[model samples]
Target: MSEVLVAFLTGLTTGGLSCLAVQGGLLASSLAQQIEQDVAMQPRPKGAPKIGLRSGLRPRPQIAGPILLFLGAKLVAYTLLGLLLGLLGSMITLTAPLRAALLILIGIFMVGNALRMFNIHPIFRYFSIAPPTFLRRYIRRTANREATWFSPLFLGALTVLIPCGVTQAMMAVAIGTGDALQGAAILFAFTLGASPVFFLVAYLTTQIGARLEAVFMRLVAAVVLILGLVSVDSGLALVGMPSASGMLRQSGSAGQVVDVPVTPQSGTLILNATNSGYSPTLLHAPAGEQLTLNVVTLDTYSCARAFVIPSLAVEQLLPSTGQVAIIIPAQEPGTVMRFTCSMGMYTGQIVFDL
Candidate 1:
């Protein structure tokens, strides 16, 4: 799979997981209990409701199976899309406004989700559909239709229609990628990611209501949320869509960067911003060859000029102030040589032929 596809798929999958953690766990707990009681005459637990981690985690098996299924399916889906398509036929030019917009949007999403963790808005309350009392009360509780899993599948397909803030942010990401088919695939993966827990809950009735479920729930939420906000690195990876690490090494081209000796490369690059920005900003190198970059920034913030190269999928902040040193050795060819500063004010590109 292309690196771009991998990152997008990972992001979409995790985003869905996060959505489920938020909703499948506590978000729907109250409703789940209500639904449980509406059918069964089982009196509410005497003193404290037994809520913990693992037990609560059991509710979304339908989601997990499908999520795992979706991951594989998404790969195949993208393959199908890829087979009918040519190599990506678009420009990879990162601009400042776009980066700032994405960051601000994400930050806003984080802050908004952060706020929602505290309390839901009145407008949101309008759409917060818990099972109605009578729906809960008289729905043939014990004999509830397990065969209707087609329901979540039905709902999951259109899950985007539900107004969730984080999902909106993801929608923006899909749109930004600028591929309709890929976006739909991303959404499908996301739905599967979120549905796992809910379906699991429906499948294993007692497990969800088991004791010690609270701790597991908290852990799941924390882990998934942390994963969802892949930080600026993810943002960079999304924009760069780097095919291989060879793109980071020095090249033999003019007006480009070249590094040697493969010594310790600087961590964060700071470049002074300027107008009429630089091009071929991202530089890559093949294995065992020293690489370097010759950068000149224009028309943007110092941070924007800063070149970032994400390795192992971790975001690496580059210098935004002035020209700096970069080294990448090539071990493979016929892959993306390098992607310059993405998620910044300006961007440059370089393709190593060796």
Candidate 2:
């Protein structure tokens, strides 16, 4: 439940604008058709009273029906895709290394896409995802038809083929769940959260001029860049590599190490996972001794509950408020083991002293 809520919030904040930048064209096209029809249906007289200060009276097109149908179809399509991805994930175990690689690759793509939005380089233009030329021609031809309802519904479903960067990130998360119902629920919650934003922005873009749309796209680009960097950092942490935060911490400490007391025989170390991050970002213990690591969470409802130790291949979803014990094998002197949340948002490490 907590995970789903997080996903929903993510969509509401970032996913909505990012998706609008990618998928708004189709919606604009559909709306253009509706406006033209409405204009043709309502002919203005030469001496008709002016509706606004500048122009004669024009019919206000009914757009609510089309927008609702489009969003409904989009929600259903993504939910089904999530279900399929989860089912496939259950069949094939995604190892920690593979998941990390996927995150890194997706992060790279997002970064490239953002650069393209800023017109950084010609090569970055290739990063844009769009329907093939042939498919686009078909869509354009079909959109010109008289069946207004068919165009919006078809285009809405077609958006699944070209998901935005944020949507793609969510899809990866859905696949990671490895459960059909959970995956479906996650996508459903996220899409539902994004619906209102998508609707309002897309609608306004069609009614307003292109200047405002350009400003909105710039804002979206900035957001995509930030998310891209964060995803890359998370992937680095998952692979036990020193991420940006880790590097900063290391520099701040100036090579100093804090020793944590542990029994010569089997020992126990307590670590707290909080909503913000892990407590005691680093720990030191004696080498060549078995250790029991107790991860405690109290009312933590974030990704921190999904504890992971990439070196040991340990992945456990801790309860909202409870403790989970992880047995660590004795290690040689100077061994360093890194641990992080599943999303790699929160991280810590334990170093064994000589």
Candidate 3:
């Protein structure tokens, strides 16, 4: 459906870019480890005494297998987590205070993690629930010494524990979906979107010995910090605080209105809905005329599917791909009507001028 497609596309583009800072280093490190292991296991030439340790190292192990397993595991984990979050959301209505507290806590955790990544100080490391020394040793042994087929899969699964502000943000939105399927779909799409970068970076490291670790890590630190601030603001907005994000505002726009040339005979206007957002978000219409708002949606599988017009008490759910017409009563001049998605994340409006 459109929702899943849109989610996938979003993940492919913006989500993938955001993930570079979060998972880029981890993917590179894992791939490098696998390559080193593969090189050490290269066959020794006949009658050739090993000149040195790991002499005549074989080429790095084909990353295709490990990368596939890693991404697949992440996809499954994210989808499952999303389903669980959605179920929990359906069971309890989160009060504003509770939601804000949760968001703020998540934001603080992200900020602290970012600082830790930057090695700002040793103290920030203590803020997280890190495994004990013994547990870390066990993990390292499993990954390095054993070198079982499960190593890449295990590492991918472990990514769920690593702090990622974008993932957390998506998790919050998934909770609003109120259904397991929708939640899973959203996360699956996001993970899929991020997979491309994971594969690309991993390939570069293994294929060409790319040395971007330092640069990418710094970029990740900056992104995590920004995401932390955004998370905190979103939480504040939940508690009746004015939202700093312009996407959620309900107030009328003062900008010049788009003059939509409606059909003179039928007073009809056609609007297209895409993944990025609604085309022509603001429209100007003539007053005192019956109007048909024909919204043409093609594979729209996003929050925008839940259309709303607060002033007219209009709430409509759009199909994944189709045309839906809503009757708009003749309005008095100077009237402005606003419509948004169910979460109020995406907005549009109609202005009637005499």
Most accurate candidate by TM-score: 2
Of the two candidates 1 and 2, the one with more favorable TM-score, higher being better, is 2
Tens digits of lDDT, candidate 3, 182-234: 88887888888878866775554445422454455567677767766666665
lDDT of 2 at 154: 73
Over 1-354, each residue of candidate 2 has an lDDT whose tens digit, in order, gives 877898899889877766665676666554555676777677678977644311334345677778877888889999998898777766765566776776677678778777877778899877766556776667667767657776678778877876765676577668878888888888888888888888886665445435655676677678778777877887889888878876665456555543556655658887888987676678777789788998999999877887889989998888889999999999999998998887666787888884
Candidate 3 wrongly placed segments (more than 4 Å): 17-65, 83-102, 113-132, 161-163, 172-182, 201-212, 247-254, 257-354
Segments in model 2 whose C-alpha atoms lie over 4 Å from true places: 21-68, 85-90, 162-179, 204-212, 246-266
Question: Each prediction's Cα RMSD?
Answer: 13.7, 5.4, 8.4
* Candidate 3 accuracy as lDDT: 0.65
TM-score against native, each model: 0.39, 0.78, 0.57
Q: Weakest 10 consecutive residues, lDDT, candidate 1?
A: 243-252
Question: 197 in model 2: Cα distance from truth in Å?
Answer: 3.4
**What's the CA error at residue 269 for candidate 1, in Å?**
14
lDDT of 1 by residue, 143-235 (tens): 245432322332333333332334434343344345656655554454444444434433343345444344444445455445434433334
Cα displacement (Å) at residue 21, model 3: 4.9
